[model samples]
Target chain A: MPKSINPAIRDFLDGRIWLRLHTPFTIEDINQQIEAGHIEIIQGIESKLVFMNRKSYTCNRCENTDQSKFTIFNCAKCEASCAYCRNCIKMGRVASCTELIVWKGEQPIYPTSHTLAWEGTLTPRQQQASDDLTRSQEINRSHLIYAVCGSGKTEILFPPIFHLLKQGKRVCIAAPRVDVILELEPRLRVAFPQTEIESLYGGAKPTMKASQLVLATTHQLYRFQHAFDAIFVDEADAFPYKADETLQKAVRKAVKPTKPIHFVTATPSDKLLVEAKSTGGISIINRRYHGHDLPTPAYISLWKYEHHIQKGRLPKKLTDWTNERIKKSEPFLIFFHHIGFMEKAEPLFQLIHPGIHSVHAAHPDRKTYVQALRDKAIPGLLTTTILERGITIQNVQVAVIGAEQRIFDKAALIQIGGRVGRSSAFPTGDFTLFHNGITYAMDEAKSEILKLNKGGGTNPDELPFM
Target chain B: MNCLLCEQPKQSSPSWQSLIAIEKSTLICEDCSNQFKRVDIIEVGDNIDSITSIFTYNEAMRNYLHQYKFLQDIALAGVFSNELKQALSKKKAIIVPIPMHPTKKIERTFAQVDELLKAADVSFEDLLIKTNQEVMGEKTREERLSMSRLFQIKPQVEIESTTYILVDDIYTTGTTMQHAALTLKEAGAKTVHAVTLIRAASEQ
Candidate 1:
């Protein structure tokens, strides 16, 4: 092994963390690096026998220890019954015989001379939260920014991120949903114009550049290992991340062991709130940056709205609401709990205004449809909870079709209502919850908004802002 | 029981046929099996006498192969094991699985053709060895047609004066089968027949 490392190998692997053995790089180059002690290989899956000689396999990358998600097959390569992790198989198959390579070469030197090109000024509340975040990073402490939706959460991250980058520290902002990452990429790129930013998601093109800042979905973090100095999880309580423990483990695995994971979200769960309070690292901003009250959802009863929609009829109250938004040429978003119901109601909504479209998680045109609404090229969209967060459409009226459904929990309903009145240009809009019957979740969501509007959750030190 | 392909529980309903015949555990559900379009098409090649395919290379079959082979989900090989068993049971010929290159076999972890035959509980012999590691899937039809000898009989294998059946996962241009059939025929086999899980629809 030579003391001098190959530059090509270093460039390909610098901050990539861990990559599968079968990568884009040539085998000869990788072999040379391995011989030079500039690269180390880790077994993709490790196995050990448990009780009664039942073998248990754990994915080295995702740390998935669940026995059900592991499957064994007679492997010709290893000549044994090798186990692979099904949980993270979509990234690539990580079997017991497979190898993952990480760079042990000299680290790339990052430029400390960088600029924060954000031209906008933060409000007093935002500045205080931003200072709190920056100070926490200076002391190497975890912090939570409990800001309301549309409270300029992304802007609050800029100063702290720039401060870290000034010290040649790598940072990653991971979100649970791809939508949040997609929304944050362009904004972060604009804020730090000189820095190399890599945005990684499921289908994103692989990049070999050594980036100082990374914006990726939490699912994408499974490929990264001890890569970031500071990792901030945006929308930390969102779906899959909140419910799936593996994603939380991925976030913890992605950052350096000595560093901390900061969480930024509008609606913090009681568990998150209590943890942050014990550490004295929580900052709450009750008001939106536009200085407008959060839109409290107004409930309207539409008994058997499903039957009318299935029977090719629109309920009267819903029709009137759509007609008003159509007449005023205001864009609207009607959330549905189920994709099937939203699809059935699509044509009826389109009949009222032919340009209305429906979108869901798997919709091919979901990205384009959201773009169309932002461009004002369409009337509105009927979507599932996928659009509950990480979207801002000015003057767009919002409604939820099945508010009583179990899918619309307190956090979900709050995020949905936060979609309204986002832009300062039109800081107030109608937020209606059309339901067959009002449930406890709906009432709780409405009252939570009222409480936040009355400055109930603001930081105690900043009570004067109320 | 769960479907081998989709991993969903099989919907079982007792019928008159269930009472009379021994119950065989359903390996695939109706929904997953229904997606595959079966085409019992047979094509006669110059060297290989005939190539019989059980299914067409439709979108569903493509995804099935991707999961079974590329993604290395070995349980999916049993998805069509029953059909393969029924088809191969009556044949009087010796079964030979198309061999993969040793390196490629090591990389893929399992021989897909051998696994397909093993899942059906049909015994097979590896009579031929792949000479080259070039993936036929990456090459065009013209390139494949022009490609040279890819298979050769194993050194110690004896080719008897009896019928031989060649089994492969897919029949693309009939090039690999033709090469293997030519190898076996040159080794003194009486006749060669091919069976593939899927026959790729001819490119226009």
Candidate 2:
């Protein structure tokens, strides 16, 4: 005999029955299975447990029994091709798995989930901020929520997003990088378990149907025409998007005429901040969620390196720096102005310290080398500007081999400096610049750091170097 | 006669157009025209004459031309073509827009003369093809004369050379058109003449 189960759980299990069974079932396992809706309990052992369930979905053209396998379902009504997979339905591409699990349903049709709730516990400030944003949405007033880096900005939007989803409003979160979209996907999935959240990017699932909520890069918004009720542009001052007019137009064109647009950034451009302040829509949350202070920048000059390198000699300053780090068994990154110069310096530096390893963009084993460095399998990495953003390594000091080169603009120099003193465990380290002469950009970057130090909103005690 | 080259009047030739004035001497106009002619004709490959422009690039003409080329005022190309259309209206030949090299077309977006010719409502054929050539060095009239045999006719063009008029944006020194004319003649043409948007006015 098997126990009875609720119809909703039974329906869910019926759709995904393969998840339930182990072939030679024990008596106890069978009873548990009946309770779990895997097998229906019968009154008599002699009577067979008949599996009775309606076909949830069927391919009209191929007549395939498995709904999960077919993405391109032929429609008998219009004789058109339709996507059955969730990703395919959202993005129109059959790239990810084809599990026909209903995340949400509306008016007897399965509606894709866009806005989801936050499952994790929120702090008092975050909860309040979330509530404030939700209330602003109800009144149709645009609000700018400015939170510091690592301030759980995404989590704070969950409650507002959930409210919007309940109200059947379409939302979109647009960022400048594909990496940011990828990071937000899983977090959103867990929060809106019932909502169909589509991650839209160059490589994301392709579909013709508009998703309720789309997490996309700014470029992806070009195809959307006033589709979203609320559009959130993350990292508003990030490169390519910030500099390009087409991307700005796409962001504007993707949002509905009467809907709200939210801009989020750690560093907003002067133009954007001015506009936000003038409109009185700006709200600032100046503290990190983890309550840590932003890192203070340090500058070092190795003027003798160029003179020694020209003479086919390694500078004592570089050798001594490496030797001390080796003695301390600490890892570091040697940033270079050009790949050609970096290649020349690599072999010579390796001769001085045989254990040292260098990697660059053109290296065939770049991924392996990066992984090795990340895993602390190598002593150091000699690299170009490619590794300047969106990558973090534990406890690694940073050195710019030719910091005075014109390529090291203020933004680039600041980003490179950011790579150092990031981890809380090893939050303080020496950031050196090996330059033949100091440049104006370097001075500007250092001055900007001093300005941030004096800004007063940041925690003064945690910035050890300051 | 006034010399076409130097614009000096010559007493030897009484006819106004029969004499060409050199810097220091007068040459007979027939002799000057013959000197400009080369026995060997250069072929305007099948892709080259697809869109031919008229207007000898000169200092005076270049001022307006810089506006068309650099400033991206495509409207000026239309104006230049209207002038060209007016010049060619007397003749009954199809207006072949000068074809730009594929690489040049990509950089410049649209060919200027092609747009001009089309705007003028003249019938044109995309017949000539251009093969890339290594620029040897700056060539003078004599050097260009010697190098006149370099261009070759593309096969299977089926051109009515006698009725076809070779068009180009400019006719500076008439070297390119001379070669193009020779090539058309080799492809069994009966007669060939050149028309440019501007002829350098006789200086004298």
Tens-digit lDDT track of model 1 for A289-352? 8899998899999999989999999999999999999899999999998887898999888889
Off by over 4 Å in 2: A1-119, A122-148, A203-205, A283-287, A304-314, A323-329, A337-344, A348-369, A405-410, A421-423, A435-455, A458-466, B1-204
TM-score of chain A of each: 0.96, 0.63
TM per prediction: 0.88, 0.50
Worst lDDT run of 10 residues, candidate 1 chain A, spans: A457-466
User: What value does the lDDT take at residue A366 in candidate 2?
Assistant: 64
lDDT (tens digit, per residue) of candidate 2 on A1-466: 3444333433232211121222223446544645554453221001122358523443221122344333333322224433332211222222112221211111122353444445578777677667777766776667667565445678888888877877777789998877678768888888887876678797665433435668999877754555677888877767668876657777776777878888876556657666656665665555445445445455566766766676667787788887777777778788887776777788777876765666665467766776787777778788887666555677677788878898787666766776665666776566777777788878876765555545542332332122
Error of 2 at A165 (Å): 3.0
